[model samples]
Target: MTFAKIELTASDNAEFSNIGDETLDGLFGSNRTMPAQGITEFYGASGSGKTQIVLHLALFFLTHSNNPRVVYVSTESFFPIKRFRELLQQKLTRDYENGSEKSADKSKTVEEYGNRLLLTHEPSVESLMNCLTVRIPKLVSECDGIKCVIVDSIAAVFRCVRKSEIPYDERSRILFKMAAALKRLSVEKGMSVIVTNQVSDIFPNDVFHVNQRLVADKKPALGLSWSHCVTTRILVSKCDPMSIPVTLPGGKQSQLALRRLHVISSPFCPNSSTFFVVDSNGISSVHENPTL
Candidate 1:
């Protein structure tokens, strides 16, 4: 019911990351009006790039920050290990080209970076709760500079629950308890908690559509119980695919699968959005100097 109180360090409240993208930086950076802590939920339909955005954030802290580590807890059956490694390599390559690294030991650097990222698999709600309440606090105690903890699709755990197996009241309590642990981890531990959530389609006149006053046709899963757990809610969605002309060796064109990230609710700025594309280089903002 309670997590052990850990002594907060001076740097615990220090700012952790700045996404290079202007759209995100304005909201999460030093210029942000809200304190740089608490839980952020990225909810969207499958293939909406929710995992990629969080992965990109984890990598950003790993590469850009002051020796900060990121804990990425994934409930997805298949974690994108190869893709994550590729992104890390690309970021490191860019840094080296920018004259950030003097040593030619790139492989060693990759290994070190890989170690800093603590990746764990929690396939069930019970396992997830244990990881959040027990394992995460242990990690924070043992590891210094653990700037952020990302749970890729926290919805996966609750999505598996059935009324026959777990009663509604029991489920709600579990959800609330999990959320409380996350809040404590964010506020007390002084680290940011990020979670991904799945979305379900809402038909016209649906109960949630009418009674709950949900404006979006596609609503993030976990209902109002888990919704209240998150300090900020962001919707990640896919846009219509468009073509971009490329000056390649044979003048080829590329089909860009654009993605949109909208701040559905936040204390700092609400109803803000930015479009981006994910490629071999990871997630990149589509518009330069995009205004939100």
Candidate 2:
């Protein structure tokens, strides 16, 4: 069989939806998620707030668009339903208090938001692939305004696949096919694809780099093959926790510790970092004045 070369043009008029946090959105250019029809990877250490960011993005996207929907697939079986509800309630309460809306109306809106978010748990690679290739497409077709698809901790799904059982070449081929399927879905469906990855320690060889010193020596998992699948990559890490004074619901003051977010790589934006705190109202920026 013979095939002709294919040429494609990048979308010039692509739109973006905010991830709910200003600092987080600003990491991507113009304070928004990467343009539609692209895959973004968020990788970080444990307790680095990667999942929190994903939940916040879903919340914001659902609220911003008319009849919006999202597909969130969790591989680690760690979806914090309590925390999600708390964040949702906080947002609804803030909007209701700030606007002239009634309490009953806010309750209805909260219910609708809950209904719009569809959650799926995939424990193995086969299940994940099936959901991505089969179930997700069906859900998108049946629902309107599905804006984003997120897979939390993609590394967890494939960590236990033995090389003896499945040869390295076969495993790689499967991963490549999966990546292609994800890319095709993003492009054809015109939706943002986001996936979270865990980090692996990278130690420099003593012989090759004896003089080099390193601080953060961790890198995203799944290696080079998976890297090509992602168009943007953000690395989140915890900085020294700072106790910042915060006002409570009844005008009481308390201290909160905020984590830092770093933008490791992107085609459209330069590398930058920001600080944020996860409170009852979701993630918010922390602005610290420079020390004299």
- RMSD (Å) of each candidate, 1 decimal: 5.2, 6.5
lDDT of 1: 0.70
Question: How many collisions per candidate?
Answer: 0, 0
Q: Write one digit per residue (lDDT tens) for candidate 2, span 73-138.
A: 999875788888888888777667768432224536576777777788999888987888777766
Give the TM-score of each candidate: 0.82, 0.82
RMSD of 2: 6.5
Candidate 2 global lDDT = 0.69
Give model 2's clash tally.
0
Worst 10 residues of 1 by lDDT: 245-254
Q: How far is candidate 1 from the true structure (C-alpha RMSD, Å)?
A: 5.2
Candidate 1 residue lDDT tens string, 230-254: 8878778776533342222223334
